[model samples]
Target: MISAVVFDMAGTTIDDRGAVYRALRSAVEDAGAPVADADLQRWMGTDKEEAITALLELGGVQPTPSIVSATFRAFRATLDDLYRADPPVPMAGVEAALADLRARGVRVALTTGFDEPVVGSLLASLGWTVGRGPAHTVDAVVTTSDVRAGRPAPYMIHHAMELLGVEDVHQVLAAGDTVVDVRAARNAGVVAVGVCTGALSRAELEAEPHDHVLDGVADVPALLAGREARVGVA
Candidate 1:
């Protein structure tokens, strides 16, 4: 039986693209570098440092610490502005699913590629502060900072499971909207469920090694309930 669910914040639980892209474009522009749309989407689910560095490399520019920092700061500021102006909304059915899971005694943990402050701000602006029902109230929040590395490494999911006192990765279901998310879950030996709300195409996600692909977060509750009932009935 799965006792907990680990969610990828941006694309999985929320649309997750607005603030980050807004921030990235502004940051790149501010740093006097041209930001390409494809590059940004390609780097989703990656940490700020890695994504910016990759972006620079793709543009045939050397990734300098100073330039990266400047772009990151600009991106952060823009994201903050976007959140304040109009926060990203939760994907349809996300709230009900989260509530149903919790009511069933399932622990929830939000895992993200974002840093601490930005995640906090976004959640706050969206009225999703910890314990704010129907959307928030996760048992824990795990950011890239909480792990040794981000997605495709399994460190983040491993760290979250440890923090949540879960011993078996199989008891955790990791859900996200990117291939990296699926890779991370697989690396940690957990069940990986992919959603198409983010950049990756449904075909792309299906081609990957994910255990399951969900149309949206709305299907999670039914998925879990069905699995649980199947186990019990058997």
Candidate 2:
């Protein structure tokens, strides 16, 4: 039985409209490393700062601390401006899905590659921040900045489990719209679910070995309703 469900933010719960990719590409290029969009997309679910550092190295820029810091600042500014100009768009039925899980007495959390401030702004705009309202709420929110590492590293997922008081990875379900999302869940020994709603496609997500793949977030609760326990709580 699943005790908690962790979800990716952009693309998984919110309709990012590719803002993350666009902002990162622009910021990296402005910082003197003309990163390819495809390369940026490949590292979509990791920390943007780490992703920028990798891009800088890939683009032959030596990735000094000053350079990485400068690029990340630019990325933050660009993303902030985009959000202010147009508050993020939520995915089709994330609220309903969250409600369904909550109704089933399952804990819900959000894990993201975004930094804290960005997540706050996005959540505030949607009125889902802490103490906002009860209609759409999550038990916890974890970000790359909050963890030692991001997706493909399992730290964020592990941290989410910690916050939700869930000790067993087998009792968790991790869902996101990227390959790293699946990899992170697998690394944490939980069920990896890929959704074809944000960044990756059904075929692209299928390239990974996920426990389940769905059209979107709304299909998650049903998927976990019939799963058996693979391990006991740690």
Per lDDT, the best of the predicted structures is 2
Model 1 misplacement above 4 A: 29-38, 131-136
lDDT of 1 at 65: 90
Give me the displacement of residue 192 in model 2, in angstroms: 0.2
Predicted structure 1, TM vs. truth: 0.91
TM-score of each: 0.91, 0.92
The pairs that clash in candidate 2 are none
**lDDT, candidates in the order shown:** 0.81, 0.85
Give me the runs in candidate 2 sitting further than 4 Å from their true place: 131-136, 226-234
Task: Per model, state how many residue pairs clash.
Answer: 0, 0
- The CA lDDT at 90 in model 2 is 75
The sequence of per-residue lDDT tens digits that candidate 2 reaches over residues 1-234 is 888999999889998688888898888888778787678777888998889999988777889999999999998888888877777877898888888888777888899988888888889888885421255499899998898888899899999899889999988999999888889999989989999997677998999998999999888866765454233332
